[model samples]
Target: MSTFGELFRVTTYGESHCKGVGCIIDGCPPGLPLTEDDVQPQLSRRRPGQSALTTPRDEKDRVTIMSGIEFGTTLGTPIGMTVPNQDQRPHDYSETDLYPRPSHADWTYLKKYGVKASSGGGRASARETIGRVAAGAVAEKYLKIVAGVEIVAFVSSVGKVELPYLEALEDGQPIGKDFSNFLDHLTREQVDADVTRCPDPATSERMKERIMQAKEANDSVGGSVTCIIRNCPIGLGEPCFDKFEATLAHAMLSIPATKGFEIGSGFGGTKIPGHLHNDAFYRKADGSLGTVTNHSGGIQGGITNGEHIYFRVAFKPPATISQAQQTVTYDGESGTLAARGRHDPCVVPRAVPIVEAMAALVVMDQFLIQQSRQASATLLAPLHTPHHVLQAKPQPTV
Candidate 1:
């Protein structure tokens, strides 16, 4: 189930707090330029201790390319990559095996597998997502070069300060009039101005104050992320089996702490009538058909319709709060457990990059599938030949 896609499959492996985590990408086109450098930047964004708001665990998160490339280009083989755990605190999790943390997967995993690793939630840890992000970077690069596609994701809500998109602007604007513009407006000093990553100077300051209060109380908070995909080609998804929205949902939910997902008009459509929800078709001045509205979110009948694709994902607060909580030990005895290891007070900001990465992966995989079908159809086209010239040429040769 970890493997995804037909023409552009990727399989991720390894565990959190383990020796390392990695991914193997198959079906990548040969001779595409790729290297470790291409994937590392995204990984750095997801690594812990990158900012004051995130966990204090310092992980370099350096990526090592193991195979599938020669001289910085792909060999049309499976690309293998790994990132070592440089700052593991196995000691912090030694007691976790004996007393599984409440609200965590420890008990469920034990019931399912009869045994589980003690260190850092084992495979269920958020650390498992590093491999996913790294692989996604590769997919993103491919999408940009091959299809002119771009994806952007940012924290739209932290607890309650929601960053709404501007109504007049399209989703793909270089600096869309909402959070995108806010991000652009801030300088590097402004970015470091707040721990919550909110672009509003005042709002960011207040969010930081609230997070600090929660930290003092040994608690955590949750929020949401909004991602936009631009320039996706129409007719990219297979109608029944691999709808674009379905694939994207699968990828997004695979991340840890993801609780809710909604595409265009999702639950909101329930409040509106069919007429209000439907996207009206119109011809543009450029002689191209376009939709006056995007209630369908650039997709119709499970296929891309070339409008901007956008969605939102909600993440739950990290379960490992420092406050003492009631829990059952491995022996079925009740005990009080308080998590000791480093953890983020809020995970939404760091998750922005991961969200964008997963989106890129889904889009790039769908693109490859679309391209393969097109190539096959092209090869099947009829060819024309000159019969008279062929007969005369044969006679002259004789």
Candidate 2:
């Protein structure tokens, strides 16, 4: 099932070495401004050959809009978008027609379909994600304008390195009157200077040294990504079938090479007692509810509590290692295989944007659900209140 969500659904199609890949978005609200231009930036972020650490497949990934829009506004119909594959080297995998790459989907795909596309893992390639990222950008724009929510994700860990919480690093920093500007000036290269995205100078250097060593050896490594979503409104999920966390996990795990996911305290919480792991609630000065500690990761009972949504996703190393390894052919003949291709030594750095894109997709779906249920005038009455209330008066001399 390529489609996801009951409302605001999206279905993706195409193969790795095919002429193009695309997605069809259904249930998008009518009159929302959308265009191919709005979706291009995010696709560029995930396209191959963007940097030294990604696959060297050079694809321009130019997107085209086939339908569902006119005059830059969506028509509440299915929106179809596609990106043509500019640089395709299908001949690279031609020699392995009968042999399957170890740890790849080639064997299973053949078994499931009786035949498989021979070019670059076909639909299983990370290239399929191009469509998802494109559609997700549209969802993100809608969420930002209509829901007032923000989602940000960065490479928190690569191999053994991990970044410290942003709040902790900002403490005791002496910035002269412009804290936001100070943060904005920090580049990814400066962050990478520490190795684990940790912001701790010493620790990051050690992590970078480790990565450099691995790169020299033609080896690869993997790590985790942390995503933080802020300003998510309360009550944005279904209870029984499609819980917020479950839907989120499904969306993330669907990404190629993602191995594991955990929210809040996650696996570590199991070792601690309930008293220690539970988030304590309190009333704020503004009379809104708040959690003293977000050990529950800003979600409780399958619903948002207006707190930051934090989660971590673990990714495995790239499978296309240069080292020769043992493998078998389609006919069960054993042989040795040495991977030959340009691939990432570590996928963590590039995965940061993918994580943010998936998070945006999940949040946008939830926000659409929220809008549908609260469209009634009575439910939206409180949202129109003024800071200073004025009493109602009788009309006179009209």
Candidate 3:
């Protein structure tokens, strides 16, 4: 269960305060022109200490490629990458050895494994996500080069602060200067311009203030990230259990502290009648098929529909807080605890890249699966040689 994907698989390892955190990515296409440069940006973005609002743990999180490539090109072998953990303070987490933190994996891990890593909640820490971010960056590069797919995720809401809900607008509707083009126009630069990573200027400032307020009060806050995937090929999903939305949900919810997952018009669509909720198909000027609306979030019947794939991930408040909390100990003895450690006052900003990474992993996996199916469809004859014909191999001269 630690690994992800059928093709383009990634298995992550290491813990919060371990010697390092990294992943081994298998099934990446060869000759894709990859290097540590292709994977580091996301790691840097997801690293702690990016701003005062985040944890003060200062880790450069520089990644080192260990194998499965040569001369800056992939060898189609498993690519191993590592990012050493720096600035670890294991002593800070000694208290967790006694009392399990609320809303965290401490107790569950202990119950399941009968033991847990004594430092920084071990693998349960958000620090474990570094591997996912790194692998996601590589997948994103592949998607960009081969499929022209593009993805961007931003902090859409922090506590009560939120950006404009642009998904509600009709096609070509505008909220601001050319806001109708947001699906294609929004860029990582615009989102990263602020600490909160919310593209809306006024809203970003408000989100920052909310984070600071939480920090000052010795509390934490929760928020959501909205991700948009554009230029995705149509028909990239399977029906029933492996629905596109279901896979996306699985990926998004796997992130640490994620409390909810929603695709376009998600919970909001419940208010609309069936007719309004349905995205009607139309022919585009290019004579390609499209939809007048995208309420299905660019997917219909579990398959992509050549429209932008958009979704939102909700992250719970960081469970570790400096505020005093009352809870039972490992022995079930009642106790009051004021936990101490480096933690984010708000996690949404940092989670932006993480959300994007997880999304990329899902999309990349789906792309590979779809490519295999499409390739098989191109066969002029049976994919395998017919048994009778194969059995008639020319008799070799003795």
Candidate 4:
């Protein structure tokens, strides 16, 4: 249950206040170069205490590679890794014994397990994501090498302060020219330029204040992250089920606090008529098929079509806030529970790396599946149909 993927599997371990947390990545291609340095940078980005908007847990999240590599290259076996929890504080969570924090996983976890972690949310904690982040880094490296894949995610909204262009851009609009251009050319450096990670200098400053306002009031705020995957290989999704976007949604929602996922036009596409929503195609300079509009978000019929794949993930305000709440204990006794622990006032900024990592894992897994299918198909003779007919526009199969 802790693992993900079919061919490119990853199994994560450890808990919120445990000895450490990490994952084992299986089915990685051999001879690909890998090292702790490649994995550490992303972990550092997801680590707490980096900025005022995030938690102050003070973990270095230093990763150590245990196996599946030799001389800095993956050995095509299961790659095991771990990150120590230096600042773990079980004592800080004593209040959980008397009361279940409202909107958190505390009560449901206890009900399901009979005995939960002695401290904190245990497996439900954001600390659990340490393993996910580490595994994602490995997948990212492999994806980059094999396909020049570029997966980048950034904070697009914080509470009510949406990115300037995105404010009027959603809900049946043409996804303005500015946002389209930004998605094609934006880099991580531009995203990291501010702690909020909103990219626009002025907008990012506003997001900072929004988070500070929540922190000052001992409350929490929610936001969304927009991720784009460029140079994605064609034909990576499965039909009927297991669509590429479906897997992406599954992966993103698996992260702590994620509540919503949307791809391409998402809900915004609902209002438009079929004529405007459809992506018209044409011949590219490379003599391949291309879409004039990207309303499809680089996918059609549940498969990739070679354009950029983009989506947004929304996270609810963290449940473990410093503010007091009226709630009942596990015994149904009433109490006023005020949680005590370091938590992000706004998790959107730190979530940037996590989103990117999960996207990489999805792409890495889907790519491997598609690659194997292609290899299997190559062994047989070509179909009797002419090659030109196969390349022609959509044919009537129904």
Best by TM-score: 4
Writing each residue's lDDT as its tens digit, candidate 4 over 1-398 gives 79989999989999989999999999988998999999999999999999888898999999999999999999998899999889988999998888888887888888887878878888888888888888888888877877888988999898989886555546566665677788899999889888888888888888899999999998899999999999898888998689999899889999999999988877777766789888889999867788877878888989999888999999999888887789887788888988889899888899999999899899999998988877787799955667667555431111
Taking the tens digit of each residue's C-alpha lDDT, what string does model 1 give over 1-398?
Answer: 67866777888888877789989999888978998899998898788997767889998999999999999999999999999988888898766866988778988888999988877877888888887898889988888887777776766677765554522223322222343334323332443345565555666666777666767778988887777788787777877967889988888998899998888766555555677667889877865577877767778888888778888899998898888898778898998887888898888878877898889888878887777776676788654567765431110100
RMSD of 1: 7.9
For each candidate in turn, the TM-score is 0.87, 0.84, 0.92, 0.96
Arranged by lDDT with the best first, the candidates are 4, 3, 1, 2
lDDT at residue 386 of model 3 (Cα atoms) = 70
Ranking by TM-score: 4, 3, 1, 2
Stretches of candidate 4 off by over 4 Å are 386-398
Backbone clashes for every candidate come to 0, 4, 0, 0
**TM-score, cand. 2 vs. native:** 0.84
Clashes of 1: 0
Residue 242 C-alpha lDDT in model 4? 97
Better of 1 and 3 by lDDT: 3
Please give the distance, in angstroms, between residue 237's alpha carbon in candidate 3 and its true position after superposition: 0.6
- Tens-digit lDDT string for candidate 3 (3-107): 989998999999988899999999999998998988888888998999898999899999999998899999999999999998999988887878988888889
lDDT-better candidate, 1 vs 2: 1
Clashing pairs in 4: none
* lDDT of every predicted structure (CA atoms): 0.77, 0.74, 0.86, 0.87
